[model samples]
Target: MSECCCGEKDIYLPELATITRMQHMNETELFLHLELDSGKELGHMPGQFVEVSVAGIGEAPISNTSSPTKSGFDLVVRKIGRVTNAIHAMKEGDKLGIRGPLGHGYPLEDMKGKDLVFICGGIGLVPQRSLINYVLDKPEDFGKVAILFGAASFEQRLYQDQLARWAQNDKVQLLETIDKPHPEWSGNVGVVTTIMNQIDIDLANAISLICGPPIMYKFVIMSLEQANVSNENIFVNLERRMKCGVGKCGHCQINHHYACQSGPVFRYSDLSDIPEAI
Candidate 1:
């Protein structure tokens, strides 16, 4: 069989994967570690996603939270509807059907030699984490790296352990903010955009990337531009309901582009072409 762009031999059929480990991030969120049943490498890019299917239930486009360099890939899930609810009920050793690593990924080449900023809000950290780890694994290729995450409260934060370790690194700057007040939290308490004002960013040499709730896009983009980051240098990950990972179904289309085919990761300069891209 010929290989598709995502490195899988077949793009339409689902590959069976075994869930080997599981961890709960909060009350409603969990991360599952998976290994392909056939023992093949996923070979997914940092921003790509997989359409995960349960036996009787349907499938949903799930972002890869774990880094491509890690031993096992990760899928972060939040219960929303039927498919995700069934996925939430599954545990380690369960079987899952997957079909991707689909969609365009971040512009790693364009990111070379530039200072980096990652803005993640809520569960958006899942996809952004992939790129963050990629940069960390190859620090010599880039300049200073910074990650900023926003949560409504301390309990809503994801990747706590890694965040702590990353924050302690002098080369990797990490900052977080909470929307409302939490006296005991003792950390930044405001929207994530506010953190932009505090970091010493060299806009001339910086590239800003963001992945967050749709509502957060407008305000966040404004902040990055105000900081002098070029529209072409800023990237955003937009997750859509990609029913058919191959793009036969029209669910993931955004005007002329299909989110499942052309993107999921788009530079602000490209996003300007689609009014509904945000």
Candidate 2:
């Protein structure tokens, strides 16, 4: 096994992790809490992803949904593909192969002392939640934090209990909206960007982190630009088609950049020149 600078084993070799908890968040999403068999931490940063493998079903790249500061790790898997479907069939005590904590994560060190704005849509909130909780865990390490979350409907929302708790935290300002009004919903009704105006932060200086559908990026960037947030201050998590977390495969290549290696999380300014990136 290859060794990293910290003397950890190769990232390509899958490690055994047992599911400590499993819950269905919605119709398609499954939340899993895992602990390594070696009794060691996953040592993952906020936006990093792991390659989860089922016995004969192969592996898929999944973003870590829990913060590094937290024990073990978490993942929210969407049942959209074969590998993910196999993962969904797993039980609380089942073991799976984990091959990462891969790729670059969000720049938390740079974000220190800066006002933060997190814009998340649908299941995209899964990855962004890691950083959100990281910041919230140490409120004194950062400035003001505002979270703007948008879901398709009341049934599509993830982490309902956690969202309510975040809303109650004095360190955070949380605003949630649905795409359309439902009989059971009385919250704001509109697209995620529609509620961007409700965020009260120093737009020009605050660092904005966005994660969601591909379509949401264009419009959300536009909204941030309109508010005068510079591209340098805006980071986006682009967890695209990353087949190999080590970047040997070209599946996640965008122009000269590889999402699996150079990204998955990048400053908007660094990706501005790459038309295929956004």
* TM-score of each candidate structure, all chains considered together: 0.94, 0.96
Question: What lDDT score is found at residue 78 in candidate 1?
Answer: 91
In model 2, which residue pairs have backbone atoms overlapping below 3 Å? none
Query: What's model 2's overall lDDT?
Result: 0.92
lDDT of 2 by residue, 159-276 (tens): 9999999999887899999997899998899999999988888889999999999899999999999999999999999967898788888999989898989889999999989999
Residue ranges of candidate 2 with Cα displaced over 4 Å: 1-11
Distance from true location, Cα of 230 in model 2, Å: 0.5
lDDT of prediction 1: 0.86
* Residue pair clashes in candidate 1: none
- In angstroms, the error of model 2 at 138 is 1.1
C-alpha lDDT of all candidate models, in order:
0.86, 0.92
lDDT of 1 by residue, 1-278 (tens): 65466874555678899999988889878889999998888999899999999878888899988779887699999988888889889889999998878888888898888888888999998898888888888888888888889997878888899899888877787888999887679888899998888776675468888899998988999988787777888888987878897778899888878898888998889878798888
Error of 2 at 87 (Å): 1.2
